[model samples]
Target: MELSWSTFLLEILNFFVLVWVLKRFLYRPIQSVIARRQQDIDARLAEASAKEAQARRLQDDYEDRLAQWRSEREQSRQALEQELRGEKARREKLLAEDLEQQRARSVAVDSRRQGEQRRQLELQAMEQGSRFAAKLLEQGAGPETEARLLSVFLESLAEMPEARRLQLCAQLRDTPKEAQLQVASAYPLDGGMRNKIEQALTACLGRPVACRFTEQPELIAGVQVSMGAWVMGVNVRDELQGFAHLAPDSVGG
Candidate 1:
């Protein structure tokens, strides 16, 4: 409570000394520690920023790889579809060609079979017609037809060529005068017809000739003159045989 100059001055001096000690020993060291802690915090923040940028770059690369894979998968799927379509079209075309070939072959075979059947029918008809004609002629043969055939035969002998008559005369000249000239017919010849035939033979040969008459039912309404190897005839049997030979033959289809 007493205001003394000396004591006051002493108190002021102690206060100044305490301030210098705190500045030198506590304040300066505390400020140094705070600066070091601030530097450590700044370095950790820079490292965190760099790591974040690297993570972003990695994510972008992964996304690009995924997009490229999807594009490649789409391309492969489209190519497979196109190949399947082409293969299907080729198989269908081959099937169509094979079917057409089979149809054409079937048609050709059917046509050939039809033609063979028609030919067989025609041959059968021809054979039947020949047999019918032969039966009809056989039933119609009689003495009237035989007489007409004999008359035709006599006329044919009268119309014989001079050279043919000479050949016949030469052939008969080697035979004996007493050799019989055989005259065959389908029916019995009357005496007048026989005498006429004998006279004609005598006139044709330029010599007298003996005669012999015979009935040959197999002649079928015609005359056959025979002497040794020489023979001539015109008969219904010969005509029917020629008609039968005209029929066509059957062949393999």
Candidate 2:
């Protein structure tokens, strides 16, 4: 409680000395340590922020690449489906074409078979008709028929073309031996008929002609005449054979 100036002044002086000592050694060193720790904290925080930004950029890039991969996969699927459809359509078209060609071939083969059958039928009819006629002609032969055929033959020879008559005359004259004139009939001839034939031959040859007569029943109903290499006949058998040999097309021709 006693106010003493000296004591107070001395106390004030001690207080100033304590403050200078704390500022010079303890306070200055603690402030330097705190400033260095603060600088280290700020540098660590800046580094953490930069690493966080890099991680976000990496995540965004990964998302974009994933999206692109999904889009490409879908496009590939669509293209593959379209290609498969096109291939199926093309194969179907080819199959259809092949089937049509087979149908056409079948029709052509059927037509050909029908034509062959028709031709066979025509040939059969012609053969049957030929056989029937041959039998009918065989039943109708006689001396009377032979006489008529011989007379017709003589008439035809008399009315022969001038050129053909001349050719026969030349052939007969050029023979190395005497042109042998052989005359025959299916039926035997009497004296009167033989004289008539001889006169006709002599008139046709324009010269005197010698004759050799014979009977030939195979002639079926006719006369026969030969001189050297030349032979003439008017017979049912020969005419029937020529008719049998003719085909349907050749009959009209």
Candidate 3:
């Protein structure tokens, strides 16, 4: 083919025109579509990243709440355990105190019982001793010796206070109406006893007194004083009876 300047120029113009049309129309529109697509993809990627971040935050929050709940539960459990332990300790203490009190009460009761038994034993021993002494006194003093001793004792008693002497005189009365004092002896009246009787009667009656003695063997070797309704007899048999009354428990022994 032979080259022509006009043809070549036309071809060149055609080529440039195609390029301008593509650039001004097709190329520009396609480029705009591509740019918009790229923007959409970038927006989708950003949204995805944001959602992932939100999910991660929510998970962390849930984990934190779970941990807090677990911690609270553990604390409550520990506190409950401690409360139970304290209650158990308190109960044990109370039980111990009760047992101690019971033991103390038992000890006191036993001690009291033992003391009572000891007192009873002591009383029994005293009674026995008194009886033994009485028996010995009975065997030692006879009727005659007892009479002589009674006369001396009366003399001493008469020398006591005036009230005591009057009381003696009153006790000698055999009855309430017989207030006068009288002294009588089965044996011969001794001067000493007679004088002592007179003095006692003089003091008792506040006047001169007289005492009579009659020989009566049936009265035994003793003196009997009668004052009205009252009569006092000094005899070994009476003394023995008084000794028996003093030690009633030891009488059988």
Candidate 4:
């Protein structure tokens, strides 16, 4: 129980020594381990931040590519529509041209058909007129008509060209001895008429020429004079036939 200063001082010194040993060995090594763990955590945080930045850049690039693809697709669709419209317009034009040509051809064919029909109708009318005229002349035949025709015949002979008259005269004179001079008339000639005809023939030939007279009703209303192969006459039948032949040209003109 009495106070001991030496022992007390000794105990205090022992406590200080224990404190120094713990600081130099145990506390310093544990503090170093804690510092290294903190550095590893900081490095991991930095690496995570870098990876996030790279991912953001890749996302932005992908969005840009998608927008470009959409623009290109829209342009292609517009170009295709324009081409289809042009093709349609071209087809319509070709169809319209074909229709016009067909219409023109049909018009031409119709015009030609109408012309042919008109020509045929005109020819038929002309034929009918010719027949009517022939019938009228046949019914009107008479002595007066016959006498007029005979006078015309004589006048025609007198009006003949001088060369033609001379040629006929020469032909008559040089006729074969056995050949007959024939005179044909629509009506029978009386003795006085026959004598008159013989006198005219003799004067034209410059010689007495024997004649044979024949009554032929088909002469219409005229007289025919024949010597060898030569014959001369005028009749309504010849005029009608000439008119018939010329009718087509008259209608066309």
Question: Which model, 2 or 4, shows the larger TM-score?
Answer: 2
**Stretches of candidate 2 exceeding 4 Å from the true structure:** 4-31, 129-253
lDDT of 4 by residue, 1-253 (tens): 9879998998889888888888778888888888887788778877887888888888888888888888898898888898889888989988998898888888888877886678678877998898898788889977788888877877776577778878887777668655667999989988887777777766665667778999888777778888768887766666677789888887676
**Which number leads on TM-score?**
2
For model 1, residues 87-138, the per-residue Cα lDDT tens digits are 8998888898889888888988888888677777776776687678767767
Instruction: Determine which window of 10 residues in candidate 1 has minimal summed lDDT.
Output: 244-253
Off by over 4 Å in 1: 1-38, 115-253
Highest lDDT: which candidate? 2
As a whole number from 0 to 100, the lDDT of residue 217 in candidate 4 is: 84
Clashes of each: 0, 0, 7, 0
Candidate 3 lDDT (Cα, whole model)?
Answer: 0.69
lDDT score of model 2? 0.81
TM-score result, candidate 4: 0.48
Tens-place lDDT digits, model 3, residues 1-253? 8989999999999999999999999999999999999999999999999999999999999999999999999999999999999999999999999999999999999977886676667656666765665566555645566468566657655556778667765654433432344665555766886777667656654556566655554444466666556556665444545654654444233
Candidates, ranked, TM-score: 2, 3, 4, 1
